[model samples]
Target chain A: MSELLNTLMQDARVWQGHRHNKTTTPSESTGYQLLDNQLGGIGWPRGALSECLVDQPGIGEIHLLLPLMQRLTGTGKTVFWLNPPHTPYAPALAREGINLDQVVMIQTGDGGDFLWTLENCLRSPVTGLVMAWPGKLATRDIRRLQLASESGSNVCVLFRERRYTDQNSPAALRLELTPGDHQDLKINVIKRRGSWPGQRCSLAMAHRADLAFRETPQVVQGPWHQSRR
Target chain B: MLWLYLHFPHLLLDHIRRDRQDQRPLVIVEGTGQHVLQACPEARNRGVQTGMRLKTAVTLAPELGIVRAQPEQDARILEDQARWLYRYAAHITLVSPDGLLAEIGSLQKLYGGLPAVWQTVEQALDEHRLTAWAATGHTPLAARLIARAGKGECTGDRGHILRTLETMSLATAEFDAKTCTRLQRLGLNTLGEVFALPAPELARRLSPEILAHIQKIRGTRPDPQAPWQPPHSFRQQADFVQEIEHSQGLLFPLQRMLSELEDDLCWRQQDTDSLHLILQHRHEEDTRLRIRTSGPEHRADGFLNLIRLRLEQQPLRAPVVALVLSVKRFIGREAPAGQDLLGKSQDLNEAWHTLISRLQARLGDHALKRLSPQEDHRPERAWSASEVQSKHKPRLTNPEHLPRRPLWLLQGPQPLTEPPTAWFSGPERISGGWWDGERVHRDYYIAQLRSGQLAWVFRDVREGWFIHGWFG
Candidate 1:
């Protein structure tokens, strides 16, 4: 009777997935409370590709990631930036307490090199985070990056245009980043594993401070930015 | 010190004939394409002389194969031989275009005696099917002169060595024709007879250079030699007897070279980042490609995979006669602590290095760039692209302790005619560049812009507000 009860106990734990629908895999904090709450593991899925879609490029996208970037880079792990839209400002990264020397930038002139550099960075043990702005990768390539991430045990985050939301993706988690009211950063959870989606979060940056250096109102927006409200 | 000199009488013939299996009469001709520089035994037996014109050599031996002599090939082959001989002795020097000199004084204790070391060297030469005339002497010059005369005697006693050297013809002593004629006029027919004359009298007759040579031979003057160091650069080549048009045929020879390279790297405890492969084509320019790695690496399998991938990506344009693999950059290989107690990084670094190398090999150069800090106050000029490396121990210091700065700096500061919504801090004045001529005077501020981006904005005080960077 005791032996039969032991088998019943093992089976009982297996059914717990139905009630919680979750796992206890080791996690890294996303630094945003709302988004973390919505995630099954309560953080950005570690060792998986997180597809981040931005409706408009450079719309406080880096602001949303600074807290987590700060946490990872604080431990002296290298962060790889593959073909970023613009050169990463040293002062900005240094302010976040990231060791600037640890950051690596790979310039991919062609598509083959783009995928190869991304997969290589993802599979490296020293690479703590790999952020790439890729030009339309095929589904097979995305799957390859996913497999590479599992071995690398790193958070591979890909930034793409919001229009790609309709395209099929194999990323473990996907979100769209946009500007919210009051200059807040808005993030909409489009897809996530083992969880219901369509969750939204808005976080404020350090409040905008103005210096009385200019008198005209003809300031142009950056290329990553399309229009101002 | 006891020295061993190895003279390669027909090294040029031996080098080219290493590919031939049969006893075909062969000769290496001079650059002028007129006279024969060296000949094999078969050609020599057929009355083909070293100084004979090509026409006479052809007339003497109709079946003789002739290959033009290249000094570069000679030096390369000589150094290659030195690298092999270095295994037997620590001190080995390349006697350019012809031979090698090895100091076997210390090796006597290791090999037990002179005969054993001689046997070992002979066995190695025989294994490689090379012909060498070796002679031992008290000095390198003595050994070289004795070996060149083909009157080699294996002995350590000074008397026996000089006795054998004394009988060699004055002409065979390698003195110039004028020097020999002068020596003959003095009625000095033998080296022993010349040695019998007083040193001061001989010094008056011969050139200062010849005086030094004789002193070095008699062990009365210092004859220092620079020991040959195996070059950090690695180069190994193979000639495909048959022209190979297919890429797969290249892999076999490449694999052999890589295995030898791995053994070499293992011996040196170093790694290389780039491999240059040159495919020699007959009657065409050699096709050369530089195979770069994503990082420094020294593994045969990883390099072979990269080679295979590259070959597949870029097919051969023409049939290749030979393939040469070389590497000029090397870094020390740090020993890894294998199988840690946590089992977290069991050869993980090695695995990643192999992965990066393979990626670099496949995608080619410009596929990998690492960022390192540059010593510049200007944020735009504060960083440079560095190659990824294994000794990544946080090499760059941040500008954190200085005035508050942003995490992400723009490629170039964007012009903003309008002011920030609010200014939090900084009236920090930065002025410079009068010396280098790109003068700039700016009042920087930490401000929150209209778009809610906390930016590092600066006013030229004359040009207006510009959003220079962002604090994440």
Candidate 2:
């Protein structure tokens, strides 16, 4: 009877580990070398929501997302762009090897309707990633999206924040992007799951011709007070 | 064959001046409903010129009457004249509002050659209380020059035609001042002088353009002209001897025309999506009835059904004198591919045609619109109504950025009542347009709700929370 109990216990442990492995393990990195290195070599968690905050306009926020969009879509995955408050110039995205045709632009006015459409698109098998400009969504709405992402494996949800919101919201990753006076970008990893918290790194904006990340030896401290040392 | 050309100097102003007995010389203004374009010959003689300030014209000739030009009305009148002349010559080209070219080459024998045709055209114009000059030549350009200069008719040999052309002024040749001066310097004052020069020397000394003109007149080169080809689709028309008061009286002729049009479409392997029916009433403006299809189609029975349905729903606004049916949108039959054992291929042509016809019968042609996608990220400006010619499909990006989006977007941005909570998952911030005053600083969030729903929310520094999209 003891031996039978031991066997059953081992089986239960293995099943539990398998079930939680995806949520615990980081599937991919942000692919930024120095930033990834400082943040424990784990990439942005998939099947969860990530929020990016920008201090001002034209500060290389779009340039930063180009690689993430390209990586997801290069594998024949469809990216659904929910109501982007601002119109993105398509030709510029195309120059970065991101197919504008595969990117579907949706314009939903209210947060309630926008959330509903996001759920529907994520449920579909064809959708690989969903990007949206949900400015100050309610806590309940964020929770619902997180649950949906968890249910839909391999689906990534990216939300762009126009301003700072409640810092305590549940998200897999939270990043803040700020512009530097020199032709460089300031990125802060405010939150991450199963990784170091409040890691910050600075990198130069990639040139139009240069798509791959080039390692810059220069490293700067986090501008935000919340960032960890 | 003879061609007639008329230059009505300030025709609109002349008509206005004759009708209004104002002491001031009047000029008909042609502008965007707010300015003057030209003055009448009487006004010009009174020192009023084109592009003169309206106030200045008033100051120069305080008694000058001003009338706004109705170009649309003039064009309609001109079209009617061209249609009447269509009976004389099967091919008629309207060069301008007042000028027409008829391919009377084959009709010459029937009308006693160039001289008789010229007389007939002149008589036709005279009957309408209009004066015009007619000329005949082997080429259209030569004839146009002769008619423009108001020079008398020429016949017999090519040399006689060339001689008649020589008497025309340099302005009649439509040459710019530089070319005219060069021609004068070369001692080539007349058409005959320019025609006598060797082609090579004339090309070198003067511009090749002048040489080409001379060659065109001499018949050494072919005169290029774009002959007007009538639309392939059919339009139905009925001429009534007397005007009819009731809409019922118009239905009989309309039905006949519809049947004829239906037969014509089937014969051409085409379907129509819209029909334009014009009712010409005696001493009244023509009433136009436009029928539109819900989809692509062409069939007589279906078209008739749609027209009958529409007429049943809405009564005519005015008494009908005649009925005319014209198709504006035509869909060509698809080429047949080798079929399977059933000897049939899957095609939507017949189905779409039937569907369109039914829709057209119920709703007029203008009611239906096909939405085509445009290459813009702005939701409100993403699609437009389909035009007659199909446009190229928008180029889609290859590396897709899947952003949560809604299916239907409001035409304009709706005002939000309150700011949204900025609970977010993804740190994807997009900030742009610092150079332009219209700037956006937003930190977009892809948030998940407890109900297993995904929403795209953003936080604006100035404004609070707004939901931009939802993911399904």
Which lDDT tens digits does candidate 2 get at residues B318-384? 6665566777677876554554566433232333334334433443343333343455443334445
Which residue ranges in model 1 land beyond 4 Å of their true spot?
A1-20, A24-26, A207-229, B1-10, B13-66, B90-108, B112-408, B413-472
TM-score of each: 0.65, 0.33
lDDT of 1: 0.76
Interface RMSD for each candidate model?
6.8, 13.5
Q: Model 2: how far is A76 from its true place, Å?
A: 22
DockQ of each candidate, alpha-carbon based: 0.26, 0.02
Query: Residue-wise lDDT of candidate 1 within A1-229, one digit each (tens)?
Result: 9998789867855554446556665567887776688675467777888998974443567766667777776675667788887767654466556666566676777887788778777777767888899978899999998898887788888999889999999998899877654446777899987767898877664332232233432243222222332
Model 2 CA lDDT for position B92: 69
lDDT of 1 by residue, B126-218 (tens): 855789999998988889999998888788999888887777777877778998899999998887777677888888888777777777876
Candidate closest to the true structure, highest TM-score: 1
The per-residue C-alpha lDDT of model 2 at residue A11 equals 81
